[model samples]
Target: MTFDHNPRILFLYGSLRDRSYSRLLAEEAARIIAAFGAEVRFFDPHELPIYGSVPDTHPKVQELRELSIWSEGQVWSSPELHGQISAVMKNQIDWIPLSLGAVRPTQGRTLAVMQVSGGSQSFNAVNTLRILGRWMRMFTIPNQSSVAKAYEQFHDDGTMKDSSYHDRVIDVMEELYKFTILLRGQADELCDRYSERKQKGVQESMSDIGRMVNNVNLSQM
Candidate 1:
């Protein structure tokens, strides 16, 4: 199916460093997504503070929540730190809860994960982020990318080398596009089933109240 209407994809890069390979990787992925006709945005994590029990209205938190709500899919790029996802990536995930007030920020959305490694190609970071995607109840696609020896994989101008890693990024973005189109309209139906059940219970309770009032009138007569 055609993912028309300009499906939005939010790219979250783990490291805030000026020349972070992960950020460069994410930008490359975004370029591919745009090439395939999707609107992609890379979020700047500099303003996002650590997660806490704060309300959804907090400025940076709200901005993130808004982007998550606006997008049909996401791309998470992080450097592998100690064989796992970096702290920056984890913090961004933590800041985005399953819900923001009445809306579920991640549910019914699609995700693709990528990682940049200091050594050889490693899937550790992407794998961990996939687990987190499941935890957030997001539909994560199967295709992923892990760039090995990231320093050598990218140019000084922030464009990544045209290699197998680039091809995988293209594959993941295309897959995410396909999955997002298939799932977008179902979001409300999936979420509202719970609300429908709650509505039914509320109606039944109101009916019980009506019955009690009828019985009281009869007793008074």
Candidate 2:
């Protein structure tokens, strides 16, 4: 199958600091993907409430869900904090449900994970995101970028300087774009599972049995 339109990608970043390196990294990736002829968008987590603190009807939550459903792929950028992904990033992922009433919003989508470290280079954040991507049933690209000493990597203009780290970011974005294009039209066939289909059939059978039993009981009354 062929894709008729540009690949839509939604980016999520971890951090709310005035000069958040993770957000800057996401911005840089967005620019690269956009240049590659993909539609890119980022979600601002500043106003997003904690996962359980508010109902899903909240404007920010709704917006996030809507974007997730609209995109054919995603980019997740997080800061390495205390040997793990930042809470800001986790909260955003938490708000996105694994399954929304039989519709897996994220399943079969392409994902690319990236991270920025304040102290030294570490894959902690990106590694964690890869795990989340798998749990969400997304096809995470193999290439990932981890920027060390993030503060020094970006210039005062909030753009990454010319360095190997920037090159890695480009590599990752290129891989994501390729994967998104290849899998966008084949997602349904690729994600279909015989086990899930069998389970659904069993559930429908049980429901029918229950209805039949109720009808028999009512006739005797």
| Model 1: lDDT to the true structure | 0.85
Q: In candidate 2, which residue ranges exceed 4 Å CA deviation?
A: 202-221
Q: What is the TM-score of each predicted model, taking all chains together?
A: 0.83, 0.89
At residue 5, candidate 2 shows an lDDT of: 86
When summed lDDT is taken over every stretch of 10 residues in candidate 1, the lowest stretch is 190-199
Steric overlap count per candidate: 0, 0
In order, what lDDT does every prediction score? 0.85, 0.92
In lDDT terms, which candidate is top? 2
